[model samples]
Target: MTDSYDRVAVVTGADSGIGKATAVLLAEHGFDVGITYHEDEEGAWETAALVREAGKAAAVRRHDLTDPVRAAHVVDELAGELGGIGVLVNNAGTGSSEPLLGMDYERWRSVLSVDLDGPFLCAQRAARRMATEGRGGRIVNVTSVHEEYPRVGAGPYCAAKGGLKLLSRVLALELAVYGITVNTVAPGEIATPMTGQEDRVPRAGSRPGYPIPRPGDAREVAAVIAFIASPAASYMTGSSVFVDGGMVTMGPQAAGALQSGDWR
Candidate 1:
């Protein structure tokens, strides 16, 4: 496997949440970062500033996963500007709240487009570059605990994440010859804007249903991603690492204890 050795990393949806945290942490780990934001240009710049504070170079770009084909080009653009991509973190994603029966086809497609198609295309771009450069790299896809479990109102989300998990495994097998490692980081409920808990400390709240009983911090998830992107993780690939605070383990127990149909 290739040693990361102060290389470049590209993180999507980096305007906030796990993406932002991962970008900053990677910079601290001797990597220059390329950040992509969907709607928050200011937040992207803020993340860039944090990377700069880490004494590493940072580049910001607007990435719309809805237009995945064109959006994937941003990977090349960032790689060109930052030298080359040594790590590709496919963290940009969208989720759905409507049930399978109530949701329209458009909504389902939207979630799949951003959550699955976008990552596939972005990974393709980054992988091609890595293969050509002849240096091993890392491809970390930020999925959710739903990848292995199910949620009542998140059919599309679960489907997309589940598909991404399998896709990562396939990529891992195919890319092994290139010395590139591919893995998935599956998180549970996180205290981020996406979860309606932006800038809030997870310890301030409580989740009786969860094993850890509180939401996870973005940095906690980022820490794992940083490790997977590092040279230390060279031997690990096609693995799904759970940063879910044991949430996935409590499904049967939590379900058995529910008092009402309110869970539906």
Candidate 2:
């Protein structure tokens, strides 16, 4: 059946991938969940149904979080509906793959607005409500390993995630006095709709450069988020935990070793 926590959580981009996983996991952990979707009402309902099946309340809203004002309002409405926001998971972000020199102003700004500004607005609104509630809260950002590393064609995404890393740190420090904790979960390659890999992974033919031999599961990342939102993680704040399966720690030569000629 469904587990139940007294806390309420707001998970943005709950239609698919990591966001959906987080929302369902939070429901299983007993938190009444508020989910936001950009244009996928069907997916949102599916997520809400999962929460209900888990025996918790679920609220779904539509939002395009690039507009900071509207995004903030969305958080406000969700908080009002859910009674109060106890956990805010900033997982609503998009990515673009373009070289710095090839990127136009609009593309860069779009990535930053969604990845960084959206989180700022949502966190601000949620934290305000959380402070008024007189109880502690949790804000977990679903960042990426690219926040610290570099990818060839994803300069804009990397920059935005890097900024998000610092944003989480700053918010954690400023909101600590209010009894709130802020942290980030940087995930590696996970099998999800976003990654275009659903149930099974194709690995028979090549099996190239992965030291772990397979991508991570979305539920695994959700487990980390669930822990951060729980009371057990009260002492942790402003920290970034990499769940990338040693991908980030691998050296330049590591990928080569997996290749036949030691070069990709």
Write down the lDDT of every candidate, Cα atoms only. 0.93, 0.85
Cα lDDT tens digits, model 2, 1-264, are 011223999999998888898999999988999999998899999999999999999999998976867877998888888887889999988888667888899888988899998999899998888777767799999999988988887888898899999999999999888789999999988888777788344343232445565687778788999999998888899999998777776766675456475231
- The worst-scoring run of ten residues by lDDT in candidate 1 lies at 198-207
| Residue lDDT tens for model 1, 1-264 | 878433999999999999999999999999999999999999999999999999999999999999999999999999999999999999999888777988889888999999999999999999999999887899999999989998888998999999999999999999999999999999999999999897556873488777788999999999999999999999999999999878889877987998899878
* Winning model by lDDT: 1
> Could you tell me how far off, in angstroms, the CA of residue 51 lies in candidate 1 after the best superposition?
0.4
Worst 10 residues of 2 by lDDT: 199-208
Colliding pairs, model 1: none
Each candidate structure's TM-score, on Cα atoms with residue i matched to residue i, is 0.98, 0.91
Give the distance in Å from residue 133's predicted Cα in candidate 2 to where it truly belongs. Answer: 1.6
Q: Give candidate 2's error at residue 230 in angstroms.
A: 0.4
Q: List all candidate RMSDs to the true structure.
A: 1.1, 3.7
Segments in model 2 whose C-alpha atoms lie over 4 Å from true places: 1-6, 199-208, 255-264
Could you give me the TM-score of model 2 versus the true structure?
0.91
